[model samples]
Target: MSADLVLDGLDKRFPGSPTPALRGFSLTVAAGTCTAVLGPSGSGKSTLLRVIAGLEEPDAGEVRIDGTDVAGVAAEHRGVGMVFQRSLLFPHLTILDNVAFSDRVSGMNRRAARSRAGEYLEMVQLQGFGDRRVGELSGGQEQRVAIARALAAEPAVLLLDEPFSALDPALRSDMHDLLDSVRQAVSPTIVLVTHDRDEAARASDRIALLEHGVLLHEGTVLDAYRRPQNVRASQIMGGRNAVPGVVRDGSHHSALGAVPVPLDTPTGSGTLVIRQEDVAVLDGGVGPADTGSIAGVVESVRVTGARSEIAVRCGDALLHAEAPPTQRCQLGDRIRLMLPTTAVHIVAD
Candidate 1:
């Protein structure tokens, strides 16, 4: 049966450090869903994972798995499977023995453990490779074996800690696909910790951004991208082109120009976040008036496969725009650009 997981007011503080690794962080995962924890390094992503897996005890908080408090349970008794970045398989043991280690610890006979391990190996699509040494497999293959070993235990929840970091880019994408397939087949509640934005966008049904041990925002991918909670969240979510602006008269007036933005809050001064794709190119040497388009010259153009990204200089601000690959424009070409009214988000102070 699938079970939901909850973290209620979790906090952790290392000795001799003024700041806590985690501070009243709380999250809930619906059964059979994947929740990705994303943050910069030292943001306590790994600490939170360890706390959930019973490796670290929070100074003052509780962890509940499937509606039961697992605070007092030992790591092995918690029935939480963890796959780490490094495949810590025994070098001398065959892949089969590595997968069966947990079964043996659970009092299964050697023959039974071997049989169970065989089934798990097949599940990870490495059936015949069970007899091979762990050192003999490629990076991706070894990772698959690690996943098989973790799944062989049949834990209630699975925790992944940047498990595909060692693989190459192409192989990493393939592993992501394999992870989706496995999740759908098993329907297990998964909590993945990662620093890769693309990986979080690709694998997670819901994404949570953590900063300095605090959860800044958590929601659907589009929700986070569309409506970031603060300037930090907006920048971390990859809206790099931010402009200082003032919201008045149902529009935001910034260095670029005026754009329609919701003025719900009391606006003295705020930041306007614009996605690169939302900016369109205009051909002209003349600039638009106030409440008009911003004028800039193409500083550089980058051809990235299907689309071409253009960098424009509006006074001192660098505005990024994406255009069709077929549209060819040379450097030093002056152009007027507009930010989509729907895409411009006013970041509250």
Candidate 2:
């Protein structure tokens, strides 16, 4: 059965390091919920996952699953399954045997273990590849088998550590959909570690931002994107256009103009993080701008087959706006940029 996962004051440090990899990390994940842990490299995203899986021991803090502390439990006995970036399947073992390894290790009869493994393989859409050697499958197929292997253990918590990192862009999307399907098939408490923001936004029920080995922010994907806790969190969460602004209780004053955001703050200096996709480029034909419009000269335009990314220079600040390929935007043309009140995030840190 699935269980809620909790961590409190989790601190882990490698010997000789000046700072801890995980510092005072705490989180509560509801049962059968998928929480994506997001962070840049060396930010303890993987370390936190390892600690929860009992692969790494925290110097201090407690890891509780369903309100029971499991800090002293061995890795295999923790009832957690991990799918690493690379599928470390045994070369000599067939796909079925590799998937069933967990069951066999748990002392199940060979026939029963094989049957259970077959079920997981079918769930992962690898129904007939059971007898194929692990060396013969493609990378994406191997990852599917690995996921099946992890689930075959019947783990209460599934931890995926960048499971789709090796797959190509197209395959990555497919794998994402596959993960969503798996979640629907068997709702287990899942913790996924990823650097891909779009993937996290699409798959995660909640996105937890981690930075410099610290848990920076935790919220719904849209909330974290709309109102990031800090500047660092904003950058990682796809705040491409970072604008320096001053908060004036009701609105923010930027190079463009004083635009109202969906937040109230004490009158102080702050920065605004605007998402490129959220900033709509208005052509005279698209629509008429309302009150919160700032005019800018188009600096450059980049076309990527189906879509165009236009860079506009408004005073000292440059805004990157995503436009359609058919939109006739040219360099040196004066364009009006409108940042929706809800799209402009006032982050004061």
Candidate 3:
């Protein structure tokens, strides 16, 4: 069965450390859903996971699982299974034995434990390799064994602390697919700690962005990427354009000219934020002036993967835009940019 995990007002500080690892950190992970905790190093992502796993106690606040406070619970009794960044598999045990360790420790007979362990190995697509030693497996396969071991316990809540960070891009993508399959089959409530934005978005339903132990924003993946709450949040989410502007009378006025904003937008100074992908670049033309398109000169162009990243200078503001690699352009080329009013998000400066 899945469990709802909650961290309420958690504050933790290590001895002799100048700053708290987590300060007033709070978030709720719904049953059968995954929430990725995303932040840079020293952002307390790992510390939060440890607190939930009962491996570390918070100096203040509560760690609740399924509505019950588990202040004094031991790590093993918390009904949580954690997969660390490294596989940490025992060298002496076969993959099957390693996965069966949890069940055996719980007093299950050897035969029944191995039987259940086999099921989890199949779930990870390693059914035929259970007899192999840890040294015989690749890094990705070792991580798979680690996941199988964690799941073999039938944990109500699963914690993954950047388990795929060290894998190559292709292998990391494969692990994500495996995770999706695991969620479908068992539906364990999951809390994923990761610094990679793409991984957080691809692996979880929601994102909890942390900064210096502070919960900056907690929302759906799309909202975290497109509707960040502040300048720092925007930057963290990879927002490229943050044009200084003023919101007044349901419109934002800036170097890109006035664009319509939501009616409830406060009338004050703000920053107009738009993702590079949202900005549509067009050829220079003397067409209709009522199209709300602005003219600019291409300052730079760099092709990255399948997209071309472009920088355009319009009046006093330098805007970043993205286009297909086929849309070739050189520096000093005149271009028209269409900044969709719906795509323009006004955030606090």
| Residue range 18-129, candidate 2, lDDT tens digits | 9889989999999999999998999999999999999899999999988899978999888899999999899989999999998898799999999999999999999999
* Model 2 residue 289 CA deviation in Å: 8.5
Decide which is better by lDDT, 1 or 2: 2
Q: lDDT per residue, candidate 3, 275-323, as tens digits?
A: 9999988754424564778888899999999999999999999999999
- Give residue 194's lDDT in candidate 2 (0 to 100): 95
lDDT of 3: 0.91
Pairs that clash in candidate 3: none
Q: What is the Cα-based TM-score of model 1?
A: 0.90
Q: List clash counts for every candidate, in order.
A: 0, 0, 0
Could you give candidate 1's per-residue lDDT for residues 168-198 as a string of tens digits? 9998998898888878777878899999878
Looking at model 1, residue 314 earns an lDDT score of: 88
Q: Identify the superior model by TM-score, candidate 2 or candidate 3.
A: 3
Which rank order by TM-score, best down to worst?
Answer: 3, 2, 1
Q: Any runs in candidate 3 off by more than 4 Å, and if so which?
A: 285-290
lDDT of each: 0.85, 0.88, 0.91
Q: Number of clashes in model 3?
A: 0
- RMSD for each of the candidates: 2.6, 2.3, 1.4
